[model samples]
Target: MDWSKSKSIFIIVFLILDIFLYSLYLNRHTEAQKVEVLGEKTIEARLKDDNITYTTLPNIELAPYISGSVKHFTNEEMQAFNNHEVLIENETKIIVTLDQPVPITDVEDPASYVDFLQTYIIDGTSYGLWEIDKTNQSATFFQRINNRTIYYNNHGMVKVYWNANNEIYQYEQTLLLDLVEFEEKEELWSPIQVIQVLYSRGLLKPDSQITLVKLGYSTLVQFTQTQVFVPTWEIRVINSSGQQEEYFVNAVEGKVIDVQFDQSKVEEDEE
Candidate 1:
């Protein structure tokens, strides 16, 4: 009923609202500034203090998560290849034995090995050479999507077994089907962030040398008919004792993945 009294009350209410909004803005600004500064320096300081050394981090900025199902090989599809005895297991894998062993003319040249695979193997172009186990006279290849390796997916890989003659006698293959990327891409965590994650979790020992750093995808979830993949960083480190280990970090989520543990769990679930 009193006009002046009502005006004064409204002014007081607006003043309180302004103060509340400004406080929220200040809090958010401070947090962001801290992140910007800490993200650049804190990780480096921690890594140095822990006596960890790494190769240069990549300049990569953005990446996307992807998902796909494992291919189910039908007889019709499996019958396409020649000169090899192809066997389909559970309609999901191709196990092949060459009627006669193919000589790998150059054991030292990795490109030569890839050539052999592309010539005699199905979906060879879809795989990237992973490792050559000289002790076992074998080589392993991992399936690739978007030109990036899918690290150690059981359902999507090739294992080539060679005789002492350095000839490929047999190889098994699997593939991912209907690969699709998510519409929304993510800003990946830089290599520094990934390393810091491992160090903070006590995964990286002091005086460790990171010998290899690569960008790839690892299994995110395994469903009965499909599997989801996410961008990950594969770091190979050698400790002070000269022992080597590999670690995977989820690029988007910044979580370290115990690859061996996850692989074992997957196998157990399948069984």
Candidate 2:
């Protein structure tokens, strides 16, 4: 073998292999750094950069010493007592009358005459019982009712009643039985709930604060709205890296709505 020729070939092969291994190491290092940065920055920060907004509603305050019962009635009975109204007799008597008969179909569940009374009659009457004058076609209370009022309208199938002591009373007459059905009302999502969602999804850091804002992005520019419906501090961020990435963050509740590459930013990076 020619020693000089063999040595030259070996040197060339070693150089090529060294270059390939170095390239692989550099790529792996870059990928690991990207993952670490992503884990640290959070989705909330990314959303803030994008200018999305979040909002929250004020809490409701309950009244003290406010209590009442519920009533239900059949359509036939309500119809029978339509012209004649029920009256409550106590220290004061209040008259309750129906311009038209209440239909059984209008009443919700837990059916009973008392349910109808609770629903239609306001509270604070001395006499608990009173009779409707069917012949007279009017409801008369023997005495004035105390701390109570009655309201009724013929437009809806069910009538709502409200009573006030310290608290305000509210009621609504059902316009159409079919249109309105009773369901358990649910409370709105709170800010804490939002945060939990984001954190659980690995979109947010538990220690980081999130700001909600309206974001508008276009081909020419991207900007955030000044007003935030939810209480939050504005945070400004710049992505110094050439790669374009997206983050998902919610204001009212910390939920990750989306995450993706920003096409415009990518184009800018290329340019």
Candidate 3:
């Protein structure tokens, strides 16, 4: 009788239901993708084709150490202690007295003092005890990445000075903060790859041999909001006349960056 008509109606209703369900599924999927995109860490990278694309992935966040013990100096205290600040581009200079005078004997043991500094004073996780030179009455800690130590006078450094009275009179630190590193450090270009890039860029001389390659952090660019340091490949090369030259390479982007050395510090140290 009307069996054929009922069957045709049933088929159309099922098709409508299928289309509605499919639309709902697509909407949910699109929403999920948006959430994922928001949570991801994205970096712009130039491809071989000379086009930039966002490489989104998880990354390691390395921030400067500011402990609860580090208190901001008040105006009266600054005046009393003779505080001075010299601001230069991305670098900030702060010379203020501590809440309590730190003793030299407390930090004379290099390793233990270094640990204390990390917990209370210095920022960044890329440092290890390098040397304790009593002649200068100071301890020198070098910035490091794994087993590879960064070249001298670059990256985060802590130079703490103590007096004959065993009182830690002063401490100096140059810190690069808020660095983003590739979670999969394996993704960084190898030392050989960086060397090739350097040679291609006419930075490395044919007669020069690379002396050391260290992984560290270098300020890529500075923003008003924050300072961003890139995971850097610091390579030192020695030439015919025994001149040692250092070059910096961005680990993630594989590009060479012009690094400015603190030559004044070198000269001062020589004095």
- List all candidate RMSDs to the true structure: 15.0, 28.5, 20.1
Best by lDDT: 1
| TM-score to native of every candidate shown | 0.77, 0.19, 0.43
User: Which 10 successive residues of model 1 have the least lDDT summed?
Assistant: 262-271
lDDT of 1: 0.74
Give every collision pair in model 3.
Answer: 65-123, 104-166
Candidate 3, 52-118: lDDT as tens digits: 1111222333322110011222344335333333222234323324555566445556555754575
TM-score of 1: 0.77
lDDT of 3 at 158: 63
Off by over 4 Å in 1: 1-41, 260-271
Per-residue lDDT for 1-271 in model 2, tens only? 4578646654554455456336545654343233223356564565465443334423422111111111233344445444555543331222345554344322222232344445464321221222333343322221111211111112111223322221112222222111111122212234434333433444443223343322211111111101001111112222333222244322212223332211122111011
Please give the ranking of all candidate structures by lDDT, highest first, separated by commas. 1, 3, 2
Q: Which stretches of candidate 3 lie over 4 Å from their true place?
A: 1-126, 129-157, 161-168, 174-186, 261-271
For candidate 3, report its TM-score: 0.43
Output the worst ten-in-a-row residue range by lDDT, candidate 2.
220-229
